[model samples]
Target: MHTTPLTADLVRGALDLERTEHGLLPHRLPARARAQCADPQLHLAESQPSGVRLVFRTRAGTVELDTLPTKRVYVGAPPRPDGVYDLLVDGRPAGSASVTGGNTLTIDMAAGTAEQRPGPVGTVRFTGLPATVKDVEIWLPHNETTELVALRTDAPVEPVPDRGRRVWLHHGSSISHGSDAASPTTTWPALAASLGGVELINLGLGGSALLDPFTARTLRDTPADLISVKLGINLVNTDLMRLRAFGPAVHGFLDTVREGRPDTPLLVVSPILCPIHEDTPGPCAPDFGALSSGRLRFRATGDPAERAHGKLTLGVIRDELARIARQRAAEDPHLYYLDGRDLYGEADSAELPLPDDLHPDAATHRRIGERFAALAFAPGGPFADRAV
Candidate 1:
């Protein structure tokens, strides 16, 4: 077997890599941005490596990766499924597996506390590959924090060459962070990037897309041919800011991105249809009854009447985002606005209701990916060939 040290050049989509006692841990946010805030939620989300993966070319019939996965458990809630690692051979789904051992993070949602327990490292192996040398991509679990301990293959491997594809940098909320998606490759962003033939650098921080200046600056500095920002859901659910602060925040965020990429095709996407937060203002709360009944669900606790006092709702946010897009597009021809509903809306809700009243299910994730690829990557789409 050929053993290779996990190096930075072999990993794609992560903004930073940290050498840990176990192995190389990929980070979606750089040190500066991560240092800007000590929010635990942000810390964990950025470390999950949603679109990160190892890319190499090899003919190894058998390949194995040693990893330490951090699995999260909500005390008293149902046990979550183990995170999935997807193996793609020559751009096609070849196989998938999950690690057996790693670390466990037991979270108490109601009490807002968490405990971490260390565990043994586990190995995932894939056998029976084609004999010819082919490109292989091992997509890390989108929802779990994993440490890359080592790589072993029956044949030697080298970094995959760049394919000259446009790099799409995307930022959004938990929905974008693959909340309920089946695996890393199937996440809406990953699927969309595949269908659109672009490289993906996903910054979909679950519950952490609060339009922080540091986050905006992170987007500003990342090198990307195309950029998209999916906002509103995190803003609404967290009830982070009211209307008075939203517009300016959006502008500031866009301004920062423009500072580094003035002519880059920038797409602003509103939140998809989340019935609970559509008409009702948010500051969403988990439905304790559902939790007690062994189901997980959320509800918007804010009153619709609060709209008069500037509380934000999904509906309100869409209008504001549209207005801002139009107001900005007048000056920036490359700026684009996409109604999130065009990807998933009320009609979609009727057919594919969000299982938890928030995040889309796996099927919905596929639906959104297909729709987004069609709308945003088509010939007339804003992200159409840069040559166009």
Candidate 2:
């Protein structure tokens, strides 16, 4: 069958796009911002296109997407599975697919080095669709860096018109990036976006939410009616800063965002419950025993006594965030705080244990999404549409 090509202009939900030699690369961070940071983890996470998708109206019986996906593998660890591409017809999941044979990124945590091995591109095809015209969305891989080479459809495709939903801009670490979620749409942020009836621009870069200045600037420049930043976990896991540095960093991050959105409803959320890092400080390390058995889990390796010397634990971060929010709120009423525990606390953890001792599982994502919707997006909530 003859195919019509669709371009990046037909895509939505991505914060930025770059035209690469292969095709269009969707990025959570724009080129200007990305150029300022040389962090490999940030580079990898932003390019994965967590909330990005191609949305168009079509009646095509078959659709094809050609992509070059870069998959990651840790040395001596269990092989990772191929990232999933989720298809939605008129807003409901219709099918799923995965591409094979792309680039491979090999990481040696002990050596602190990574290398990329190039490979051929792969295609994902979805056939047997109905003839009736419908809105179709192809959600890109939430965990793999995908270079969208081509989008082909049996029928001509056009961009889905804006539905006048409020734009929600959110930034955080892996949990917000859909870590361990079963599918792209089922990610907690995605679920919350759906429930809040908003258009989401997710900047949830795994292992890279270090309160970077460029990230704050990106948020400042972006147009968003509602904004949130989930902070702390990444800092603890990386042991990036002491308590004194964290307070200023959080303030600075919020300051930059307020530059662009002076009155926007900006929310500051602390880290969710991660038992390992609650009282113990980090540099969290993977549990080798778990990994050897083909399971992945993290254990805090920093000394608890180091908390006296200004090291940060999840508990420390939460208290600091609350203090920062309260002090700032006196001057900036629009700024707000939601204890991350409210979304996923000790009680919730008891019911839905985090399988990796870090990231929440698929079921917990739903629970957090639902609770977030009620607390932040419901009537009288911080993000509620006042016009309604």
Candidate 3:
């Protein structure tokens, strides 16, 4: 077996790769953004690498990756399923594996404390490849903080050549971060990118997609042919801003992106049908009653009447986002609006409710991806591939 040092050249979707004692740690946010962030949530979310993957080409019939993953667990909540590593051979789903044990981060939400316990590195192995030189992608766990330890293959490996697909850069909340999706490649953004025939750079920071200036700057600097921002959920749940501030903040984020990607197709997506937060305001809280039964659920504690005073809600955000997009599109033709409910609306929610009252399940993720691909990448759509 030949072991090769993993480098940034072999990685896609990450903005930076930090050298660690174990190996390279992929970061979705650049150093400038990381330096500007003071929120521990942002730090953790960015490092989780929602859309990051290792891309290479080899004729090896066997491949192995060693990784140390930091899995998060709530204090009294039921244990989470292990993080999954998905393998794609020549852009098709090949196989999936899960490591046994690794580092754990336990959080006591009530006590507002967290503790980390380190463990050994785990290995994910694939024994039967086609033994033909083909592009391969090993997508890391979307919701776990992973440290690449080593990569070994029976044959020499090299970086995969770019397939010349248009890159789609998307930013959203935990839903886009693949919170409950089956695996990395099955995330809504990933599935959408695949169906749309584009490369992906996902900045879906779980619970951290607040309209932070640094995040907007990071998007401003990133290169892409298409760009999208799924807004509203985190802001409403975090109670980070009032309606008065959301308009300008959204505009400022787009302004920053336009500074670098002036002509790139930009789509602004409002929050999907999160029924709990649809009419009610938030500062969403976990239902401890449900947690007692090992079910994690969220409920909006803020009153619906609070909208008169400018407290943000899903309904309010959707209206404002649509208005902003429409007003701006007159000057910026490339700018577009996608009412997120159109992807997962009241009808869809009735059929496939959010298991946790916030995130879509794996099946719902696929549904949303199919909806998004049809809407955004279809002929004459905002992000349509003209070359196709």
Best by lDDT: 1
- Which pairs of residues have clashing backbones in candidate 3? none
Model 2: residues >4 Å from true position, as ranges? Answer: none
Q: Candidates' TM-scores?
A: 0.99, 0.96, 0.99
* Residue 211 of model 2, lDDT score: 93
- Between candidates 1 and 3, the one scoring higher on lDDT is 1
Name the better of 1 and 2 by lDDT.
Answer: 1
How accurate locally, in lDDT, is each candidate?
A: 0.95, 0.91, 0.93
- Model 3 gets an lDDT of 0.93
The local lDDT score (0 to 100) that residue 155 gets in candidate 1 is 98
Model 2, position 105: C-alpha lDDT score? 95
Per-residue lDDT of candidate 3, residues 1-388 (tens digit): 9999999889999999999899999999998889987888889999997889999999999999999999999976889999999999998889999887789999887788889999999999998999899888999999999999999999999997778889999999999999999999999999999999999999999999899988888888998999999999999999999999999999998999999999999999998899999989999988898888888889999999999999999999999999999999999989999999899998999999999899999999999999999999999899998886
Q: Which stretches of candidate 3 lie over 4 Å from their true place?
A: none
Candidate 3, run of 10 with poorest lDDT: 105-114
Residues 203-322 of candidate 1 have per-residue lDDT tens digits of 999999899999899999999999999999988899999999999999999999999999999999999999999989889888888989888899999999999999999999999999
Model 1 stretches astray by more than 4 angstroms: none
**Mind giving the per-residue lDDT tens digits that candidate 2 earns over 194-219?**
89999888999999999999999999
As a whole number from 0 to 100, the lDDT of residue 264 in candidate 1 is 95
Clash pairs detected, candidate 1: none
